[model samples]
Target: MAGTNRILVIVTSVGEYEKAGYRTGLWLGELTHFYDVAEQAGFAMTIASIAGGHVPLDPESLAHDVLADLGTDKRYADREFMDKLTDTVPVADVDVEDFDAIYLTGGHGVMFDFHQSAALESLIARFHETGRIVSAVCHGPCGLLDVTLSGGEPLVRGKDVTGFSWPEEELARRADVVPYSLQDRLKQLGASYSTAEKPFATYVVEDGLLITGQNPGSAKAVAEAVVGRLR
Candidate 1:
């Protein structure tokens, strides 16, 4: 991969959803799909987490049925890829200048930590201010909630964006378990949020340098959108 094609992939370090009494972390499909797309486009990728080391995988994302259906599950079994998830760089150690784009991967676990990191928020702002591509999928958009550009305006304000919808959250039966509704928060931040008519469908919204996806199904589309922008 060329130096100019470097991409930073950020995933949550949080491993469990205590309130829901279930394991939750990076949604495997979300990260895997986007990663495959980016890598095939000749981009060098680095995995990072809010707290660093041992990024967790949401158990639900690794269900046998889910893995079998996607067929791309071999990515989960790939030793090199799995090893990368075992030890991710801390967000604080990341140099924003090294990447051409920054992507946020999501899971229910992100709702617990993605939005609360001041360091991650600052890195995102820098990425945006410098005109690098900023992309996220599903609950990944939660990371954008508190990001402000150099002029202090919310990054998503007045921008067209989409993430895991409230309806989808409700459909997943995690409405109460999540810390907050990502769709509602993005709307409150002044983003023009939209989604597919049905839950779990592909929906990608690109607003200049920022791109977002509505669900796991939208992950590849979101990455392709970012690749298009980079080109």
Candidate 2:
């Protein structure tokens, strides 16, 4: 069981940078979905980000109602596991080959940095070339914008995928911080994206090495699908 498939979970590190900036990162449920399942499946997991330290969290995602009914019961009170999130592998310094698959977790903050990261783009490209599973959910799909296959085609082009929809983006704008809409950009990139009847409802699409989920609510299903493909 030496190399029983290592999973690299990448969380967004960007927070608001202007005056009175608050810490903002991944959705709490997004991280917990795969964390609970991957650990049980015996896959070694490493939490990482575009930068190496202090991953933030969207305040709304931590509401009692959101965590109370998720698949994992103890995700909220697990302090030790929560501490692991503090230390992250800088995408610029890590070797993608060390991981068997990569899962990008989402938050509104990802829109600020994930798409523009050259280091992350390179890592994902190598992950794709090696035939490793490259997965993401919600705003995390922003990271996919920079990934190009060996033929120079955007990895998501012609790939069936879904992400934070425009309607959901409008809703979040009414309630929280969101820099830009992932759905608009993905569509601009020529990705054939679709969604569920409700914005936050669970919806997933698996096209070759890419796997995507519609919103935070779909994180668990997306994680399950990634695990299924890896198996």
Candidate 3:
């Protein structure tokens, strides 16, 4: 009951597929920016994953060019951040209603595991029912695939949301790993998914308790929206 203001962040534990084989997990910078904004707003935060342990990271996203202008925060190396990823609670072990908000963080890895997990589906449903903020960014939104409200409609139906667009995925694709596009899936779920002109530009949509960010560039904006909800 205490720490009622804490936010629960979900990241994917699965790495790149054995066949496609490229590094992937939570987008490091995106998660850090989100935690920074949430913590600064005085909300405690905890990280969770489908498997409950260490999450992977995408190697390409760690390049100097990507981190140079914007994603360079050292929170990526912080002990606290590292601890959260390694010791994350399993989605099945946590009570979704304990937190005020749930933010799904993403990387290509999420496309591999976030969508098919029943544990995540249950959590999202509970969070939605409680009217708490339920958000995701980039491939993170893939996790929303199975979330159905009490009436059995896709939780995102009629909601204003955004995620990694198909074009962006094509632009960022590696030769080996190909992930399902979040943009397409969200539209299929009846979400009014919208975004900015390009993939990396910041874009976010807020519809009641649902919020989504388009890509890594939108991490800060996503955090700001979560903070806005709390206020």
Q: lDDT values of the candidates?
A: 0.89, 0.82, 0.82
Give the poorly placed runs of model 1, Cα more than 4 Å off: 1-3
Model 1: per-residue Cα lDDT over 49-86, one tens digit each: 99999988988899887776455489877998899988
The candidate 1 region of ten consecutive residues with least summed lDDT is 64-73
Lowest lDDT 10-residue stretch of candidate 3: 68-77
- Candidate 1 vs candidate 2: the TM-score winner is 1
TM-score of 3: 0.92
TM-score computed on alpha carbons, candidate 2: 0.92
Task: Please give, for residues 103-146, the per-residue lDDT of candidate 3 as tens digits.
Answer: 99988888878888998998889988988889998888898888
Q: What is candidate 2's lDDT per residue for 122-193, written digit by digit as tens?
A: 898899889999999988899999788789899888889898898987776633455556777788889998
What TM-score number comes out for model 1?
0.96
Q: Give the candidates in order of lDDT, highest first.
A: 1, 2, 3
Structure candidate 1, residue pairs in collision: none
Highest-scoring model, TM-score: 1
